[model samples]
Target: MEDSRDPQFASLSVGDSAVAVLVDRATDDADVIHDIELMTCSEYSHLCLGMPSDDTGDLAMYTNNKEMHAEDRLALWPAFHRDRLAADGRRFADEGYDFVVQHQVGSRFVDYMNHVGESTFGTPMPESLSVVEKFANTATTSHYLVLHQALMERRIPRGSKILMVPAASGVVTGFLSATVSSLEV
Candidate 1:
């Protein structure tokens, strides 16, 4: 286990963005609830935070006026991109991030976002598509897990700029950009 008092860990909190400590289950042992991985993130310098201008009105569309169905919501996803995600793509470019880590709701969603991203940014946004395809599941930790996977694979070079757009229930979306530090896994 890493100590929060350590300089390396403490340094993560110096950035403008809020620090997050991600804990994920690392073992299958029935008696080992304590066996886990602790990821101390927030090493990057904050660049920007973005949210949709019209959340309440937009949320209704996602919920289909409070009558949301899984299939209906999935079908409506393509239209949803025209709103916040499209705007965020421009923001991603304006903020000068080297790459983007989109919310991995599904493989199809990621691919669709990439397609939309190409149109919005005039070039394909580099993202971890393979991670989403391989994982094949959605979790709140998807972005963090994807980042950790990329870092572990050395795919994201040190000091590279990164943008993350994560969406959630109630039709909320968030855009966070930062410069990567020399964080070790």
Candidate 2:
């Protein structure tokens, strides 16, 4: 399989809207592959075909996965979360993104992660927290849903730079950066 992080996979231009789909599990079963393709098409067909050509949005996506040494996933959450944020989170901030749509696994976890992010990035709490706080616990789809909510609410202005960090059980993390556009769902 091709690495989604490769520039060739995400060769987005200024006006392009990109979608990043990261599958942590790989299977050679034809049925499974068919199902995955069907799901992707069904879920994102609108974004792929309905977005206005004139909308000048910029999007970039990258995913990171740390090899697990411990059997218990929860045991490594804090360290993995903190370390990834310290590295990529700061880089994103330095690049001048408007805000991050952080994964809201839980209220306390989100707060803890935000504090860690602030300390690591040497910045105050981001305005994106409003979305996190509003929608308390969206498990796997926090990043995408939160971003959509923010865009729908007009909290993020057109052309604003945005970052989204979505993490999962395997310590899989994705960094998606996008520029807001006039395209509406």
Candidate 3:
């Protein structure tokens, strides 16, 4: 765009303009539970990785209990989702995007992006970690924060596509894929 945009949203989409959302965290439980940060950090991470075990039989026991909060199953969910993203990047490249966002998983999330880019596509990965560094994460909006950060800096390529990954407890995870439609925002 030829006009200036709000600095806070430079690297992110302007509502439905950039992002095409498929799902939202709207459910009947949303009306009843307002405070979701009810658990300790360790307990939260445990939802993704179940308690450790030494014996195969013990592990199987965990598997039987409603999937036992099965560590392997829970762990594989994220892996499978992330692994397929590289292929998504590849397929979307022809559309002028290089898969330039939404690789976060933790502090090492950026590292994972570069690693996957190298192993899967033989290219250097772009980082979106500055979103949290510049402006702290707001639960589900972290991905947008990074996107906006990139846009504010004019780091994102105009018309290029980007990806946003958001995860929640109860094993809920999501992805938002969008194209940069404006240089101003």
Model 1 stretches with alpha carbons more than 4 Å out: 1-94, 128-130
- State the displacement of the C-alpha of residue 156, model 3, in Å, after optimal TM-score superposition: 1.4
For candidate 3, give the lDDT of residue 65. Answer: 20
Lowest lDDT 10-mer window, candidate 3?
30-39
Candidate 1, 1-185: lDDT as tens digits: 14532223222222323336544553433212211112212221121123322433321111221222133333333344334445555333444556677777567666665666666556557654246776744456667777778888888877677666664433444455556655557
> In model 1, what lDDT does residue 144 have?
75
Preferred candidate (lDDT higher): 1 or 3 = 1
* TM-score list, all predictions: 0.50, 0.48, 0.44
Sort the predicted structures by TM-score, highest score first: 1, 2, 3
Report the poorest 10 consecutive residues by lDDT, candidate 1: 31-40
Give the CA lDDT, 0 to 100, for residue 40 in model 2. Answer: 15
The weakest ten consecutive residues by lDDT in model 2 span 31-40
- Tell me how many residue pairs clash in candidate 3: 9
Estimate, for each residue in 1-185, the C-alpha lDDT of model 2 and write its tens digit. 15633322212322333445444343332212110000011322222232222333544322222222122323233344345546654342455567766677556556665566576555664565435567555555566677667767777766566666554433444455555554344
